[model samples]
Target chain A: MEKEISDPTLTVSGQRGPASHERRIQIIKSAHEHFLQYGYKKTSVADLAKAIGVSSAYIYRFFESKQAIGEAICSVVLGKFVVALHELASSDMSASNRLRKLYITLLDMSLEMFFNERKLHDITIAAVEERWCTTTQYHQTKYEVITKIIQDGRASGEFERKTPLDEVVMAIVETLYPFSHPILLQHPILLEQSEPEVLHQRAIAVSNLVLRSLAP
Target chain B: MEKEISDPTLTVSGQRGPASHERRIQIIKSAHEHFLQYGYKKTSVADLAKAIGVSSAYIYRFFESKQAIGEAICSVVLGKFVVALHELASSDMSASNRLRKLYITLLDMSLEMFFNERKLHDITIAAVEERWCTTTQYHQTKYEVITKIIQDGRASGEFERKTPLDEVVMAIVETLYPFSHPILLQHPILLEQSEPEVLHQRAIAVSNLVLRSLAP
Candidate 1:
């Protein structure tokens, strides 16, 4: 791995903040709920500060704006995904099974977060669509995980990839797009069928497809 | 094998239009350009009518709303894809080669439409996000094409799909998604890399992944 990515839940530097990192985490936790309920645009900094029992000035010391707070919340969510993915990567399973589990878990997590706190999903969509650094960093993390798995799969002789490693990773990521993207989860209207179970089934099938394509 | 989808470009009943079907097609052709120029929301009936040298009421006689006009444009664009796909499918190529060509052409068409007429891509995204019947019907057409190709592949002993044919088809579409979807095209910012050539390369890589997965 080029750059080791460890869990940074406690270490992610606040974009700009009051001295206490814990205080920033507290603010994010409070703001996440309000943002989800009211959406990114409707949620106000003054209101979030009030809910967090901090003055609006204090909130500003932690976040530049409502959108910034939403972005921080996004980083926290992505951080959690990374942490979970780490555990999945270390699990004692075949490379293909591990990859399959990673996608299933990733999609399920997105769907859960989307339905449970859609505001986060909405904010995440904006973060992604705007190519916000938070989303980009998360995707970078995902890319590394995929490359590592593909490398291990090749080393174990579990798969033979005809393309360059980066290209193969791109192929797998694009292949799993519909099954894993948060955008797809939020926009069931975009799919031919919106049933949750059906999407899950498709996710599994796609994993198998990728794994089959890689058989050595 | 089921649900015959053929050239209905000349036959779709206008939402509320003048008696002449040809006139409806003419109105759609005109509105398509305006929709591409000014976006779905900005372009108005009056502007479209003026551009076509007709009264706003006449425009309404051929289409119910600016959105309806947008939907018709989507239908027309989708109709063209189906026609082109038929030609490709009927060509004497291996099933994998034919499937590859279908996605390559579909994505290139989206890119061309996006760059040439961004407003149309914008409107098509709305129609898709809003689940307009035009977009859904196009998907249905795509589904049929996929089934036909897969069936041909199986009969020729090119594939041994372990899953149900629908599941296999879902895998293929999901795999081709980032390459073929209009929403993905318009939101280049959402992707990790937005360089057109890189996206095209990824599209080819994903097609090979699908074809390899299906090999008997």
Candidate 2:
């Protein structure tokens, strides 16, 4: 949380001209597709360039490295989830209900990636493993949203005001780690038997504990 | 929790004769040493055989595969922590205090493996990724211990009895995932900044939230 995490999507680096911007977006789109088709590790810069009718060097003109492209892709993919969290936090509902929905939504998104978007999940695993800035940014953004909800809950007299804000936030984040962390979610034990309904139930149960802790 | 998990350490085949038992123990000891020194994946069965002055087939006589050897080692390694958890749960301390110490102890043990036993940490990653029976048994045992403490807390008028026992246990288990799951502990973000004191504080903060939820 001490380090500043810049958004990779905003730093795509091909803003020379409108055409150059278009080319970069085109390259990123093709790269995303290639990553999905052949997986992040299997799809190389050469493959991406060839698929886009460009050279590998041209691909580098946009992305500094394969991992950079991966970072860009992850930013876009994880950005949606962050936006969802923001919307959920800002929703017109009780802070407690919003908190419950937030975790359940987080679980649903993660399960989606694990079940339907396997290749994207692979990229996410790599991103998390490699400690991509995007992943750090995502977590920081999540922390901020959770902090906002806790503040709102306190303001609305729905949650306890005695516990330190940082402590409560850290505790809630740690509680959600298994659902939010890709590696833990993909662990054989969870992945093997994670029927969506069962995971939802677990998420609700965990959220209830968080709510109970926050009760005034 | 449905599958019955047999103890790998208790099933260390070759209980034929006293010398045979001695030889089996020697093989496991050498393998554990080699794995610690060279790494689990890098130390092959043949390498272990050469290190122990025995044939690979001889090693296989007592173990089915290299993974099986890893499982046995993991069982022995994880078993110690399981014993500590049982002891903590059975202690005369208040159930709430015992629960707090349990997670702190869990965090300490994981940190010890991550910081001091890097090779052993690698073996654990493999065990978790491969879904070894030892890992499953370790989790189940941990779950049962947590359940026991929660039961005691409720009986002693320390914790609420309204929530379903399974729900509370699952919530507590999920809450402790970051501290207990080896892969999450090894994540770059955590490993990079996890000074023991900082981690212990986080553990205490999290345990406090858990106890709040359980309060009568």
Candidate 3:
């Protein structure tokens, strides 16, 4: 799906200048801080405007809604995550080893957001529940990186070539849902069981299972 | 973990009369109706007592808290689900076929709850998020049924016996998380995409992959 970023000020017909770009960044920064402190659902667009010393109408020129600002914040966070995944996928490691690291990296990154950046984590949960474009777009990019890794693995005779590519990809993503998906990760039962050491062991075990299924 | 059912009236030392048993059933039924109408979180024990024309202290004799009443309601629902699973697991079908059926059944049942019994579905989601005993106990029973199916497959020489039984069981459960887990299923994005036909096709694909991995 196309990202729903309908900033009228940045449109081709409107053609806003560099100051508008700077203002957009400032709005996002202030919103991010307020959301982290008061929670995404609790903080209002009017509150964001007041904190930034601007009118609500002025903030509206840059982003359409509160969720739109949320999407902007999510893009920054999820985009960096996708970039890190791309780097790991293209690194000079065996396909099997790289796959293992990718799975572990996903768990570690989400865990970090949960424990260290908790309020931001709530925003992420909202992004997912509300189906924000940033969340969908991020998944799209992450899937491409995974596809590349799988194709590379097959080309190098590291994985079986018989199963259709999409099925394999879906299976892998579903299998890793407990670790990778934000809602599943925040599950109180899963949270209780997620000692760092215990999670490491389970991630390795799950990784090994995926590798076994992919073995040529 | 053991189920946290603390009904003081039901213990051997305090064996209540048959009237007490009837009162307990009445309490659960009234609570279930109110929970379905208003929601588990919204309904208070005092309201329940008022509805049933009993004192709050009398209600406490049967259940420790509001969550305990929620658990009793969940047990009735989830217990029926487990019984159905057990029947399916022992049915006269090939192990591979039975496993596929089990996966599809899980998806169908959860989707049924999501679409048809939406208010009750909210309670289930709360049960999972709160780590209610009913949810954990249900998962434990479901896992055992899955384990039994895998064991039968291995005994019949239909599945590879080399993978440790526990590892194979864990792998299968994790792979089926999207279909079976309440939190994952309630995700709005997933719900949007979960037309029955699409879900059926994906479940089949995932089951096929697992069966291929289990082949000797």
| Model-by-model DockQ, in order | 0.66, 0.62, 0.48
**Which portions of model 3 show Cα errors greater than 4 Å?**
A1-20, B1-20
Estimate TM-scores for all models.
Answer: 0.87, 0.89, 0.87
Q: Which residue pairs overlap in candidate 1's backbone?
A: B17-B61
Q: Which numbered prediction scores highest in lDDT against the true structure?
A: 2
Please estimate how well model 1 matches the true structure, expressed as its whole-model Cα lDDT.
Answer: 0.74
Candidate 3, true inter-chain contacts retained: 0.40
What C-alpha lDDT, on a 0 to 100 scale, does residue B163 get in candidate 2?
92
Scanning candidate 3 chain A in windows of ten residues, the lowest lDDT window is: A6-15
Q: How far is candidate 2 from the true structure (C-alpha RMSD, Å)?
A: 4.2
Model 2: per-residue Cα lDDT over A43-98, one tens digit each: 88888888889999888777778988888788787887877876787788888998
> Is candidate 1 or 2 superior in TM-score?
2
True contacts reproduced, candidate 1: 0.79
Q: Which regions of candidate 1 fall more than 4 Å away from where they truly are?
A: A1-14, A18-23, A43-56, A65-67, A161-163, A191-193, B1-26, B42-56, B161-163
Full-model lDDT for every candidate: 0.74, 0.79, 0.76
- The reply for model 2, stretches above 4 Å from the true place, is A1-20, A187-189, B1-20
If you assessed candidate 2 against the hidden native complex, which CAPRI class would it receive? medium
